[model samples]
Target: MRYAQVYFLFLVSLGMVGCETTPKVDNPVLGPPPPRLKSALKQQKLKHAEIASRANDRKNILEGDFEDSENPFETPVITASTTSAESAVEDTEDILSDSTVVAMVNGTPLFVSDVIGVYNFQLKQAEQRMPPEEYQKLRRALVKRDLKGHVERQLLIHEMKSTLKKEQLDQLQEVLETAFEEERIPELQKGLGVNSPQEVEAKLNEQGRSLYSERELFLKQQSAIQFMAVKAKATSKFSREEVLARYKANIKDYEVPSKVRWQRIRITYAKHGGKDQAVGLLDEVIHKLQAGEEFGVLAKKYSDGTRAEKNGQWGWTRRGSLAEPEIEEALFTLPIGQTSQVFETSTSFQIVKVNDRKEAGHIPFADVQGKLEQSMINEARMKATKEILEELHAKAVIETMFDLDEDDVNSTNSAGP
Candidate 1:
């Protein structure tokens, strides 16, 4: 599957499996927050200034206002500075009182509340399941990961909004809303086991979501998907000759390995009490086989292996794939439609019957041509999509708290005492 298709499916699944809402706490007379919370708050405030500074620095570097370093490979170290204790406290207090802006995509601000809202249920579960330190760590990691996705999504959305006319956008939105109501709502109703649209709405409300919000999300996603699909289709094209060349270059990958379909009656030494008892039991099994009892029936009654329930059938194994060297050797050499004498391995005693075998061979190009061509097209689509995203990133002004935090850490480490 293409990345965009997989991502679109993921979003759809999330919308279908809505998050459980966490109830807000309404306690009074709380003491100071934990050290981790304090640190996170401080970092959040610091990132705002640091991101702007880095943006200006990058702009200056591009404009040749900053001189080139003597060693081009070496990083230009950033000097660190200290903040006043009183100012740091004030910043922390402000963050506690107001929603911190965690990221910016173009001119749009993504608040910390917005980022957390996406994963509120998951974070709540983590807090209950993990220790405070571990939960804090996981929370940071989730934020960083989701923040990247949010940035990319916003970039795509911005591209879609900019590229389409207002009327065209409105038409697209109308089509999506209609489809959601006609197709998606029905599916959601059946999946949720609800009989009415009101029940579906109520269920979504229980998950801190509304039908309007879900519809809006659907509209934005469908627009982005349509834009990417159109872009990818325009760029991804391959000829028969190109596909054939790729096939010939990677012919070994298309080669089929030798395989066998065989059966066995395994008698583990431990299962029968010991090696001596196992040997005795094997003797009885061989006697029954010689008297012409059905091997499958006997295997079902006595075999201790994984396929014992399936009449000891080891269906279609490739050469060199089996861990049991003794069985693997016997598998290829044993004649078809015949049973072998009792064989002993370190852990077990076993007898085998070979049913069928296939020789190693290369797949014909004519047989796999269509699939190969499709695969090549998918690859090209992915590459085209990547290039489109890169172009978008170049044109868009994106800043995230995690990026600033990393920059601040690097600068601090570089500016040693």
Candidate 2:
């Protein structure tokens, strides 16, 4: 459980999570641009400088009915400065300090801002589920663990620059230019001082990156995206039988955990009053039920929970999944269609009725066949992509400026961001 492996999983899991969540794509964004776009790639190189000079022309092209292709970068990301007008003015040239230099990959500086920005990106997925002290410990080590992946990316870019054909690079640069002009500029215009080419260059200068440097970055970023897409496509050619075999080998993944469906009436102890008031509320609910008042009407009126409108009928849930262990235990043991005694649990005083239950079993193969195949293909693609990264990391000379020990890196990586 090295940090390297965790970091690898961290990266791969994003691509795979995307695979699971999104509808089965004919082509993933991580893969290559479509053929029609490929056919239209300009053979002539477009200088970012030339692009800068022709701001109005580029604007025209953008505003033109020349239906732009799907931008691989999709939309350019917002920088720290342009987040607000005040932030843009105050943060314009001050965000990057000497400490911003976190690492170097083959003489290229990797900024603390870059590391933190990337870390925050992952944090938005979910908070790192660790104790406060552990989270602080992991936070210091987070950037260190991610450095290798970033280094590998730079290394791949270096190699791409050296290996790709003049025509190919030119085409890529042109494609990058169009994407910037069309998608990025509009996004940039929404921020400060980016309305024209001069202002755009000024903004880059303030940030210590010019059009040239930004183009290099775009080249690298797009190259990384295209590389993943290409590798994914190559690995995605799995035979139907191979996919089925993969599904068979990992049958546990398709298991339906034994679950219980139950109805509940919860009276909040935390909200209205202490345990006594909660008990009083629960007593009132029970009397109402005894008087033949409907559970749905009672829940919709008083219960503070999901399925309250469905008369407190919580959907089927597997054992150990419920937050309140005692409640789950009570529900499992309670007779079908019979109410439980008013019991004080963690957050509330509640009564329950078991509606239905299901035993643990394998999901029908037909039900999950498409999902299984997609998952298997994505897994293979992720594996191939990881191999590519490992190769790049092996060859890259990477060094970090910050003091972070191997142990901390390992701990953070294994646990993730």
Candidate 3:
């Protein structure tokens, strides 16, 4: 089953999806699992991305069903690669401690397990979607990238600590411990087949996650992301001139495109008529419209395009955006609530009607000030976060043990631009 389908099963078990919207993409913050519980959840035949993508509705999993349900960590920050396949690996207990060290930051040891923990979930999901040869290449790429991510995370935590107040750290640690002990740890214990905290510690230790290390790892990640979010949200407000300058720079975004609420009676040559036959058929359609036979009824009966299902309704379309430029020009010139002259394109003969019209125009900046300001703040936060990560990267003394062959580097480019 697809991850979405499996998430639905979890939702069904919880009886929480009643009329709730299912989000199609994972939240930037929540869908990637936390390092400690990622592999644990995968063992339950569940996935953090599955829950995080739908974090908006799965309130109990993140927050109560309110507008502010955000997962603290988005998958991208951890995976360093696109897939979360590492989460699928069963916790070997000793992988991090047993393997050769991949990297170190600030003289602190970095192990393969740390990188593996972050991506096991991503890897699991990637395997389901890709063929084996490609998956193998991606898995190798993720190991090197996420190994760096592990180091970056440590550096970020080091930077973030200087910003948070001692009291704030205390409070955050309290909340993290409470959540883990009261909720997350119990869920993990059950999933890992342990009945007591000591057994849980022993099992995790066998896998290289002693209780202290697990708590510290969880706390460090949570603190860094939370602090990062705080910095992102603390962007200074834009001045009036700045806002106006932005408005001018992206003026087209605020402008309303010329639009027509319209419908089409498309007579494709192959289905309803051929060549001259298609033109003749459209002429007959126009003649019937002039004779007062209902356009919607005729379209329902004979129109072969998708709009036939909606009585030939195109609803609303913007100029320059329609598939048919000829029909677009004809319709824009046609008066609202009136039918156009019969028009032919390479593929179909169309009889269109303009139900309504909106002339192209810019939205006044005064009217969009609030929206523009919020957008500015969001952009600032993202920029700020990127800059902060880069700065931390520059300051960290880091080392890596792996390098991709040329084929792996080419795969990254081939995967996208």
Candidate 4:
């Protein structure tokens, strides 16, 4: 396959990685506000002053000083500062020089910091996946690739903004803010145990770092997929037939793993007179099971498990699924008709009777048709996005003059202080 085909295939396969394994999607910090509007405002203020001066000049000319050259307001046009525009342009240019400038479609002031922020996040991810020695070697290259990707995304975002309505932006902002405040923040705080507003802020700040990291991850994924979607639109005209074809080609990608329906009962060692006492109690429960008392009734009374009321019955066991080795071992070893001896887990003490077992099974295709269709849609979108980015890369005047030395971190642009 050609490089482009290989690239496209790699991008397609990337979608299959589990979200947990994927870097958390972090949103870019709105950051200290962009200076574009501020610059525009200052220019407007100057323009207003010039207009007033011109009006006065006209009055003076009408009053009799006919000197056109000396006129204080010769047409009072304040040329917007080229310097400011150039600075803004250069800031974006510098980043885009070594990276892909997707498109400044929306006229939003793109920032190097935003792309750099994203690059740092991807670097951290690379560091996590590789060994220390390999990470040190590959980190800069990885970061550069990430920056290239982000700049391309920024271009796409700019394009999207140009076409997208202001109300849409407003609606998106409102929805995201609601999610951040009402859902994400509260849940984060609850998990982190923040009580007061101050603690909440502090916790969020800590989480904010994490959030930013994840946002970069999210941006890459989103930008990649979006770039593909936009590309596919221009490349292969996707018809219902093509969608069906793509759907058929990638149907296996949509299968959900079989799940075992089961209930759990836990016996708390602390509640059952500490670990030693719990152990002794286990011996007694075993004896009762031998004597033929109903396992379910005894479990309801004695198991300190959260699901104790239901009985110490975990309905089924799927191979290689359970995290606890002891419980999993016992589940597989115990005869289907019998009960397990009291086993201690990291959290508590427990005895379980496998009231039933459901063998792992494949979900029927008809049952998952809707989900499969959505998967096809997403896949199609990705294909289109990749084509868009390839075009963007082809058109962009990217330059990577900056040295990325692995050994001399101090000399490299990527070096950390």
Q: Which candidate gets the maximum TM-score versus the true structure?
A: 1
- Candidate 2 per-residue lDDT, tens place, 1-417, comes to 212332343244334332245434443211222122112112111222243335534544565533435786443434332244333333222222224455555445666555555344344333446544444445556666665556557656665544454555566566666666666655665675467867877875665556665565555666666645554444555677887787788888888877899888787777776777777767777789899987778988788677687888878788989888878887777777777777677777777888888877988877877777788777887777767665544444445544435522332112111
**Clashes per candidate, residues 3 or more apart or on different chains:** 0, 2, 23, 18
Off by over 4 Å in 1: 1-98, 113-116, 121-139, 234-245, 265-313, 321-327, 341-351, 362-374, 404-417
TM-score of each: 0.61, 0.44, 0.53, 0.33
Off by over 4 Å in 3: 1-98, 118-140, 159-172, 179-214, 226-241, 266-288, 302-306, 321-326, 343-350, 363-372, 386-396, 402-417
Candidate 1 Cα lDDT to native:
0.67
Compare the candidates by lDDT and give the number of the best one.
1
lDDT of 4 by residue, 1-417 (tens): 212332343344434333344223342212122333345434544554555455555655565543335675454332232224434443223222122322221234433345454345455677678765466446434445454455556546543443334554344344444444555556656877876545666654543345544434454444344434533653333455655665567667644443233334466677876778667777776788789988777778777745667665554446678888777766655655566666667667666565445444455555656665676666666666655655544433322223323321222211111
Candidate 1 lDDT tens digits, 30-82: 11221333344467667655654565456555654434479976555432222
What lDDT does candidate 4 reach at residue 10?
A: 35
Residue 53 of model 4, lDDT score: 52
What is the lDDT for 179 in model 2?
68
Between candidates 1 and 4, the one scoring higher on lDDT is: 1
Cα lDDT listed for each candidate:
0.67, 0.58, 0.61, 0.49
